[model samples]
Target: MSNSGMAIRPVLWDGDVFRVLDQRLLPHKEHYIDCDTSDKAIRAIKNMAVRGAPAVGLTGAAAVALGAREIDARDVDTFMKKFDRLCDRVKRARPTGYNLEWAVEQMRLVVVENLSIGIDAIVEKLREKSEALINEDIEVNRAIGAWGKDVIPAEGAVLTYCNAGGLATGGYGTALGVIRAAWEEGKKFHVFACETRPYLQGSRLTMFELLKEGIPATLITDNAAGFLMQKKKINVVVVGADRITANGDVANKIGTYSLAVLAKTHNIPFYVAAPRSTIDPMKSRGDQIPIEERPGREITHLGGKAIAPAGTEALYLAFDVTPSRYVSGIITEVGIITRPYTRNIRLALQKEAGK
Candidate 1:
């Protein structure tokens, strides 16, 4: 299945500019923000104009390409020095998502391998590398869907959090990709999207994609998940990860750990769907994965309107970690990784590397 027809594309490279579908206006207005410069692209990633792990990674690669073009260096060594700095900045845009660093590193390798080539050729190679990341992400997502669809029950409800749809990837999604694959294979299932709070990516972006695809879905508040699970309304739980540690621990949207805990309590299967790029082998544990902290205003305000007292203090931790013990399986493009996660996760990644 090709992702050519995916209705929602969160990131686009338009030859001249990196185009990001402004997610903040989603479910209300569809808008695209054009980033012709690296700074603009970095700002888009930082401000959540374009989000999701895979999407941000692809955008970061594009930012490196754009930054490469702006380098005034005529020699390969000088260009690489500037390019390294650019990659560092892009990687720092969002610390939680491994894909950002992974994607930028991929771009960096392209330059390193072609150092003998002229600076102009390296720039062109960076462009090609960014485009390759886009295509590769779509293909990887489709493969993940193929492997993960089997986990979806023939006819049951699947609970998901945040926006892991086409809007979250190059095209097809991670968690939502599994759902989409099952749907395409004629398996009937209802989706319950948790309205991920403070950001509302689930209610806005996820629902928007679900409705566009004509999928049967319901929107639920973040805290209502356990009640629904108790009522047996939820059959399985699946979510996308910003980063997966070597031990198979997952760091995702803020409320994902809660869902995982609830799923475990209810004896429901909890799964994480992501491309291999989202895995950080360097991080041996979840705590080693940096959790991004957003501004308190995100919690105290909604759509630029104040919802709390002027001095109300709020803690907006953008993500939370779910231990491998809570995860039933991890669906990757390579395959579904099951426990003993420490060993299995390594084998899965080695398989992905064609080792």
Candidate 2:
């Protein structure tokens, strides 16, 4: 019940200014970016200053509120037009994460429903809604942790990719939340954090969170996951999702699919922990989801220094999809949805909606 050890808050809004922990400078620098305008907020998301699905979404909601406050509309019709454009811009800031669009839509709904209240009231409501999202995300993540803690073995190694921790969400995390919950419940287990290449979020952010929480963890190269799995060092795989399709295909950091494959081959339970908002009902399968290709410089350089030849060409696909069949279970705040994901995912989402 006490998250005293998990003292990281990646996103924060204090009425007027939107602030985000610049994740790009993590482990080395703990800098926070003050986004006073919507453009600044969107830039933070694009530059990876504020990242991870849930964090991005929470920031997007705040960005909408910031934009709404700046709009000089006198009437409902004028406000609605400007608000629509603002939401579209925020949604396009990052195409891969469903949470961004979801959060924007949530703010948009508040605007639509409050049309009778005038522009000033709507702007105030937007601010309130954004703050509410921050609280809701933390609560949802805790619920996910509660449901997923049982999946973690009492004494073993749990493999996780990327930086799904307090750094990845409003407060607590999705996948890391499960591990944290298990740890809090007195489960003895070690964590194998993949040093996700190009970005190194696991090495920088995940390691930072684990150490801060006093959880036992080891850092490993992304490629070393299979070697450890083969040796039976890993008991389970739990990672966060950027987007999940209706059929239960998961889109996460680029190397997630590989880890899922390795976990499946090793006969380890591969779990995807995420909030219900991460699920995209619009996409029936993984292939239908749009994959965001990042700048090639991300692949060609490290720490602002070129690691390859001047003319070297590289591809940077930010994310990859893991088919539902490889997943042992899809962990959500509602519960763990197992095989026959199409049916179970639908049922689980409906259950969440009812709540």
Regions of model 1 farther than 4 Å from truth? 1-5, 352-355
Q: Residue by residue across 60-167, what tens digits does model 2's lDDT show?
A: 999899999989887889889988999999999999989999999999999889899888889999999999999888888888999999999999989999988888
Model 2 residue 152 lDDT score: 96
Q: Residue 171: error of model 1 in Å?
A: 0.8
* Cα lDDT computed for each candidate against the true fold: 0.91, 0.92
Model 1 lDDT-worst window of ten: 1-10
How high is the lDDT of residue 195 in model 2?
A: 94
Native-referenced Cα lDDT, model 1 = 0.91
In candidate 1, position 297 carries an lDDT of: 98
Pairs that collide, model 1 = none
Candidate 2 residues lying further than 4 Å off, grouped into runs, are 1-5, 352-355
Clashing pairs for model 2 are none
TM-score of each: 0.97, 0.98
Per-residue error (Å), model 1, residue 69: 1.0
For 1-355, candidate 1 gives per-residue lDDT tens digits of: 2434377578887878889999999889989999999999999999999899999999999999999999999688788888899999999999999999999999999998999989988888898889888888988988988999999999999999998988899989999999999888999999999999988998998888888888899999999999999999999998999999999999999989999999999999999999889999999999999999999999999999999999999999999999999999999988899999999988898784322
